[model samples]
Target: MSLFLGTHQNRLDVKGRVSVPASFRSALRKEQTKENHSLIFRPSHKMPCIEVWPLSIFSELTNSLDSLNLFSEEHDDIATTLYAEAWPIDPDREGRILLPDILKEHANLTDSVTFMGLGTIFQIWEPIAAIERCKAARHKVQQKTLAVPPKATKKGVEL
Candidate 1:
């Protein structure tokens, strides 16, 4: 997998379209198998940012839904949560996507937007908020509050 790794800042155009960083576009190009190149955008449940997922990654994410009981409330709720606010977006020829109004409002995005790479997924955040988030993440690391998990064995048990 081509991991998204870096921070990029771009201006949102008057039409609310923002150009995706070239590296991210390339990563998506490598991952997409379908003719229509697209991404999934949604308001992150836990954060004040827009979650950006390449189509393939989004599919893999939703696959977890298969584990839930069919037609059960738990399954319905999860499915609704995942699909309700999610929007599929195709970048224009210039590699720009029109930000949905809801997502823009959720992230408090104004003129400038920051694109943050988080390996499997990326996030669109307001520039200042992105900087603060980065600072907080660094602090957590310094405080030893976050660490890599143990590697999993073939049996799927952590070692």
Candidate 2:
């Protein structure tokens, strides 16, 4: 399994290029030896974060979505919005990718940004927005946990 790891806050230069955190670059390097891996940035419908995925992962995700009924309104809407917004990007020699102005505006990214790794995909978020979003997520998890305590497990295993 290819696990994406790295969470570093970085600044986007005036030209819209941002360094892909050392850890993330190393992970990408390990995944693609010589061939260049393209990065795709698209607006995330479900959140304020910008969706970013490697071209390989992007293809895999799209293929899975392709199995859905394309004629259905829901599927058509999803496909039109997500696919149309995706922008393919290649990191420069300095391991920085130029974020499209539109994507940056959609994600509310300005001077500073937060890069969060999510296994197969990552998200770019404005600093304040990212902090608030994470806090809300943590609170939601806590509420759910309190509502239903974990059951005892065999061999005393717990999660």
Candidate 1 regions off by >4 Å?
A: 150-159
- Each candidate's number of clashing pairs is 0, 0
Tens-digit lDDT string for candidate 1 (1-159): 788889999999999999999999998888877765678999998899999988877888899889989889999988887899999999998999999999999999999999999998999999999999999999989898777766756336556
How do the predictions measure up, each by TM-score? 0.90, 0.83
**Weakest ten-residue segment in model 1 by summed lDDT:** 149-158
In model 2, state the lDDT of residue 143: 80
Per-residue C-alpha lDDT of model 2 across residues 46-138, encoded as one tens digit per residue: 887798888878877788677789799978887887799899888889998898888888889989999888887889999899889888977
User: Residue 70: error of model 2 in Å?
Assistant: 3.6
Per-residue lDDT for 83 in model 2? 90
Q: How many backbone clashes does candidate 1 have?
A: 0
Global CA lDDT computed for model 2: 0.83
* Candidate closest to the true structure, highest lDDT: 1
